[model samples]
Target: MSILLIDSYDSFTYNLRHLVENATGAHVLTIHNDSYDLPREKESLNKLVGSVDAIVIGPGPGNPDSAQDVGIIPYLFETFPKTPILGICLGFQCLCLAHGCTLGYLEHPVHGQISRITPIDRNSLFRDFDTDFDSVRYHSIYISTVTDDIIPLAYSEDQCLMAAKHAQNLHFGVQYHPESVCSEMGSKLVSNFWALVEKRETVPIRDSHLLQTEPLIKHFKTTLEYDYKYEKIPKVDILSACERFPDPLLLNSALSPGEWSIIGLPEPGRSLVVGNSREAGLTVGTWKGETKAHSDSLWSYICNHMSQRYYEPTIGDPELAKCPFVGGFIGFLSYEESIPLTVNKITSGPTPSTRLCFVERFIVSNDKHTFVVSIRPRDKEWIQQTKSQLQTCSEPRFLSSVKAKVEKPDKKSYEKSFYDCQKYLHAGDSYELCLTRQTKVHVPKTVAPWELYKCMVKNNPSPYSCYLDFGDARLLSTSPERFLSWNNQLSQMRPIKGTVKKHPQLTYARACELLKIPKEIGENLMIVDLIRHDLYQMLKEVEVTKLMSVEEYQTVYQLVSVIEGRLQDSIYTGIDLLRHSLPPGSMTGAPKKRSVEILCHLEDRIPRGLYSGVCGYWSVNNHADWSVIIRSLFNYEDDLCSTGTTRCFRCGAGGAITVLSTCEGEWDELNLKLDSVLGIFS
Candidate 1:
């Protein structure tokens, strides 16, 4: 069935659509009216009456008392007496005005407000309205006085006419919104309204809905609250809890939890889209029923659509920054997504492209009290179950200890590829080419993915590190590079190029000597320029905030640089900025486009997946922070043939190669990047 929904300039109209469609199981078509004005033509009103089964006049920005404003509501009231109509907030005021009542401005206007209402009398509209019905109120005007024909259904603390219904007709109006999450029985109230048209029994409708990911989301939220939501437990305790979870799909961040540590996932009613598809995060960009397909080709329109549906509503609010996934999405960009932009399509891996909705189960976080955290906890049952699942690796039949034999190309083959890239540099086909290869780990079957993640975090702690799960394919990332970070009008990128092998024995004087090499400094300068070029497309007033600075990690001392820029007013979306700077310049080399093409041909097509890609959060306010998906282990567990210790794992590692790059030294650079990650192999 079709419902004609007239939008009165409420930025939150479609959010109601998500609730209405889920509650009524009907399609809702919307038309935005200007200043509360609907189509006045006789033919237009006739067409609307002929087409729709019911009408929903939505909430809006202005007072309904204006003679010029809300003209259509009164017009429709007289013209279509038999049609079913429900009004909320502004529309409710219009209903009062049409029925000979005046609207009064509240002494204190409530914006983004939520309040409770009690049903004083029973009406056909509030079938399920129980004691103390929770309602969300966000309007400044109230139905001041109603004629004897208008009957009151509910009242608030201040004695406002919170709801009204026609004495002789089916017309119903609610002073408070039942569509918002803050309104406890909002979905139920909406469901009853729909049942009025269907003439069916009203069923229980949940205010929130979580798609296919509900199981993982449920386990994560429940376990997270049960374990570390309040207390600041040791990091290991959280890890033990996450490892007990039943599902293979999970996400973990090595961040310290404080206030945001207790956030639970939003329910399905909060989402416009829902899915439970299980595909790897690395190679999959969009899975069936899970998310939309926005290939590089469709990205422009996708961002445009998102800006309107997700961003426009957040323009001037003081709390504009806290809304999650306003028009945001979170997932991985496989190394292969940009292959078409770089070299020809090299179908390197069997994984498909997948990206998930940040619309449902959403979270909004900033750097302070509300930090974006990735916590992984097992099922509450814990230890005994964890023991049975210990051996997740594909090692030999006999159980063995720590030392893991690297199973990929030999040292000679890596040096050979290094020289192959050098030939391209000499030919002037590339500037700097980032070259990389994956080294597989083979060991005893007893290696738990959770234990390996804990070890990786303990040894190499990074600000943006995470354990991203995609069911069978999981990524344990400890990346140090910030490909891009957008916070409101500001944009940033931190690229690490120059590397110095760090060891306990190496003195500061000796390490300084190694780090001061001209070659390393040149590499850092080169990529910064490439990054500057990439950022210039979407940003203005671009500048380097930090020159080559040394960030000391546990095992490596690397030269890092930060580029900052003001987002261009014309650039409303940053996904294009992401596409523009993809496969990150530090990983692809200088003169990015040409360098990436050269690497694809020179290094042999190794499936990059999450490696060299990125993972982070995206907020509706056009804000984001992403880390280069590097120094990560990709574990591909075979479900059918899988027994204990039968999983295939690879740690992808690489570094920048310039014309001055030495073939012998490149492998060592790659090895140092893999240094901390190798503990997972142990």
Candidate 2:
């Protein structure tokens, strides 16, 4: 049997797809009804209905009547009257209305509420259903009148017609979501519906969504569950120890360019790095399972999941006043979802483009001269072994064998892409599109990433810098642009949008003059507005702490903006804040959503992987920060490598192309932005 699930886009649509597929083992195809008709000539109405044996309309907000013109549901019922049909929530109201019933607004709408369901008729559909069961109902509209052709099968506590089976055909409508995990009887209800479908072909019964690595909220009221202490280790010692073992994962950050650092080292084969929230503790290359392609929803789940976990905590000595979540999620997401703002996903780049991570042992720095080692109560041995490793640091390791052989994009190709971005800007599809390109580097295995990281910091350092080895790949990021930062203590975001590369010949006045170009200012304003909207999702009143301000970096000066909002609610965690602001605005362009869609289409729909994503840490104190994945070295193993030692490394850069953007100008900006990374190779 096949089931065609028409997605009306509820927050749980992804969950719905999984439930229906796992429950029936049916071939299920879900399409966003709103865009199903895109490219109408190719996806004609007939082509969509050719393979399905049944149509299941999933739940979504909004009235069914309002969606009549966007979907083929009404026509499908008219053409395939006998095909098994099921309507869930909005879907139910939709099919019900098509069958000639009138709908009414609920006196009081219930969203995410558990309500009693009393089956009024012992229809075969309710064979195993309890006389009164619980189900989740979230709706503002209800079936006010059931025409003679429709028989009400169930009612809510308020006597609302919650479920009805069409008397004339195999059509069934249920206003309550049987698939919600919150409802105890949801699964049985769904199963029963499936059973009915089988008996009639069939008989049936029915219904129904982070990274929960550690507890999201800090336990300040509860006694400190862990203890801490610090050590004054020589830099040579820590560096020497890390060199001895190249097999373990390393996440290191510096207090300054080359001195003082906090490094988190996880035992080999025991811990991992994650990019997608769905896969926790699984390193980059080992992830074979599917992830939520829906970027927005995926982020929400990741934040909620990570915040709620009670991961063992690592206590710091004297505790750095900033207690970041000792061990939690880290990594980047590919902005490849076919969101409304972007074109559909049509690219198949096999790179594990999304990576997130969880850390266990942390070696932190309180002062540049002093450091602390934090781990769970039982991880004393691991901590000691780490310290012991750092103890052997007098000699330097020979890591660089060959320089990165960089391959730049064809000038014309990039110019063409820049023009492509402008086309969208002119079309109003996006106000400021971050169009990026990368240089492919054929790297030697002996050219160690850690060594390159050292060079990057020495040559060009930033406020947010990180170096991580994810087994399959290593990331050395030194980004001045902070995508988002949250202090369970406070909520704010620092986004970098404008740019002006610095040079010996350029005076401070001249640099500031170039940064003040009208186009740069306009681009910054467009992104600031979009970012303010993002912050507004969590905060009722977001404030622009800084605007059109210039922040100088080692290689360039950026037009930076600071926006903050109150996180008065303690229920939110760093994860929650990130979800509302992933694939940072500066990278996505103004009108973030549509711009992503536009870029996807222009980039051949290939996943940006870590190129435009984020790299950062959730602090032990419940604060977190991530750098935009720009001006970073991204490397990974390749099967195409004829030599085992051959690897692929990339340094990426892009600029926001506004209507005022010229191909030559965007191309030059990209080159200047990436000079920090590509220059290190020279």
Where does model 2 exceed 4 Å of error? 1-229, 232-261, 272-305, 308-319, 323-325, 334-350, 378-385, 388-402, 639-643
Question: Model 2: what TM-score?
Answer: 0.61
Top TM-score hit: 2
Residue range with the least summed lDDT across 10 consecutive positions in model 2:
204-213
* TM-score per candidate: 0.53, 0.61
Candidate 1: list runs displaced more than 4 Å: 1-305, 308-328, 341-350, 357-405, 442-448, 505-510, 637-645
Residues 425-498 of candidate 1: C-alpha lDDT, one tens digit per residue: 54434446788887777544566665566667667766566665544456777776678877656788999878
lDDT of 2 by residue, 388-415 (tens): 7666556654433337678886788777
Candidate 1, residue 284: the lDDT equals 17
